[model samples]
Target: MQDLLGHLRSGQVCYSTPQGAMISGDSLELLAQLPANSVDLFVTSPPFPLLRQKAYGNEDQQRYVAWLTEFAKLAKDALKPTGSLVIDIGGAYQRGLPVRSLHQYRALLAFVDDVGYRLAEEFYWYNPSKLPSPIEWVNKRKIRAKDAVNTVWWLSKTDDPKADVGKVRVPYSKSMERLLQDPQRYYTPKDRPSQHSIGEAFGRDNGGALPSNLLSIPNSQSNDAYLRACKALGLSGHPARFPIKLPSFFIEMCTDPGDLVVDFFGGSNTTGRAAEDLRRRWLSFELDRAYAAESVVRFIGDQAPAKVLKHIEQMTNGQVLAIDDSA
Candidate 1:
């Protein structure tokens, strides 16, 4: 993994911890330099192709599928045979119309059919805190419901990619708990309309229940360390940042400790921080230098605010500082 870091130019690296490094550059260019078949998981939420443009950058909806497929081609070569490529892409409304764009679906097809990656599974991230969008249709007119779900496509190089649902299982629900307490008394094993026969093994305790494909996580980071540090430094954090739990969930399920995780569109470096906390080797690439430099705050644990600011200043000056994880 260190050799992967060596491939990056010193100027590209903003900072490094024992487990990961944050690089500032075009992800496509940086990704091309790394050794092929080296990444264990390439997970990220690239900028959405919306009707309007954002500060971070987004391809026009008309060209988004092709634009993203270019990256997918390179990413496929960089991923291990058993590795997964998970992308969280939000949907968009067509300009001046109530219709939704199909760019995300098109990208999925391109990644699988064109790029030769398999669709291991599809997941949807439901952000309960998301604001109602396309006010023309949803709010004033009251026609459409709030758009709160982002389609997450989990792709892999092979049919059997490395994954373990046990790693991300959720606690059993209230009804499930009652059934587990006294299975024979509270429930009966029988087949349902689905035609799958239920057996005594269904009453066995598996520690936790398997999670559904629909993930319900909120994106309400009003006062996290990353935002606080950015506030203190008078810097603007990445506008399109997803919740850390989003990437953390995938990292835990798809890769083990010491596995390599790379996030090419590393806005706010959420994936990098998640990988670091989970003890996986990581590298995040952000095109904007300021956003890359400010993301170091995510790794500055318990360090004095003054010293942390100094480190940010050094990164802004193009110096790569070694982070003290113990701090």
Candidate 2:
């Protein structure tokens, strides 16, 4: 891991494990310094362009496309020929109006048409636990339904990126399981109204059903270890953190073990933790030193609150805390 990231000598290493490291610095500068074509997957949930500014900071709707495309241009050069870049961006409503902003779509086009990235695929993340937002539209006047879906753009440097749907398959539905049990008796192989022919291959159980583009993951994390550690140390956790499942899904599908994964906007370092668990080398960059230091809680297991606090202090004081996995 050190050999791969030794070039990043400028940024302060907040902490590190055998698999990856968390660095505190400007992501744009850090990203530029990375060796060209070294990263396998660059997945991140950048701060959304919302009507109200978030504590973590966000680009306004007007300049959001330009701001994000700058990063995309750099990431394109950093990615390997067969690498992938996955971005999870939430939709926003127009100021004082119920209409939705098209910034997300515009950014997508800029990444492909301008920055030379290919549109590998698009995904919609449905967060069932999301609360009804823009209360004036959804709760008070009831003009628009609750915005529960986020646009996840999967961009690639080349036409043929490294991905395997089999790696991230879901369990078969109940009806499908029944059909698989007795294909000849329960179902007939015939052409459907869609003009697609059903063959004997449908009966074969391929471990699990292929997952769809629409991912349903709940983001209701209240008592997780990261949060608990933050509470114990009297530090506020990063406000907007996507669930672990979101990054884990793409990590499993897009890259193999030992592949390099990077998240530029590493809020709470969720992507780093996910990659470490999967045995993939990762680097997470966050601008705020405090957040980067506090993120160490995600890696350390069941240490005393005082010990965790001590580690965080060391990181905040520009000391590198090498994590002992055996502990």
The number of the candidate with the highest TM-score is 2
For candidate 1, which ten residues in a row score worst on lDDT? Answer: 221-230
TM-score of each: 0.96, 0.97
Candidate 1, residue 111: the lDDT equals 94
lDDT of 1 by residue, 1-327 (tens): 568878866338888888988899988888888788899999999999988888888889999999999889989989999999999999999999999999999999999889999999999999999999988899999999999999999999999999999999899999999999999999899998899999999999999999999999988767366776677666677778888888999999999999999999987899999999999999999998888988887878357778878888888888988876575
Error of 2 at 275 (Å): 0.6
lDDT of 1 at 110: 92
220-299: candidate 2 lDDT, tens digit per residue: 75636677667777878898989888999999999999999999999899999999999999999999998999998888
List the candidate 1 regions with Cα displacement exceeding 4 Å: 9-11, 222-225
Q: Show where candidate 2 strays beyond 4 Å.
A: 222-225
How good is model 2 by TM-score? 0.97
Clashes by residue pair, model 1: none
Clashes of each: 0, 0
| Residue 299 shift from truth in candidate 1, angstroms | 1.1
In Å, residue 58's CA in model 1 sits off its true spot by 1.7
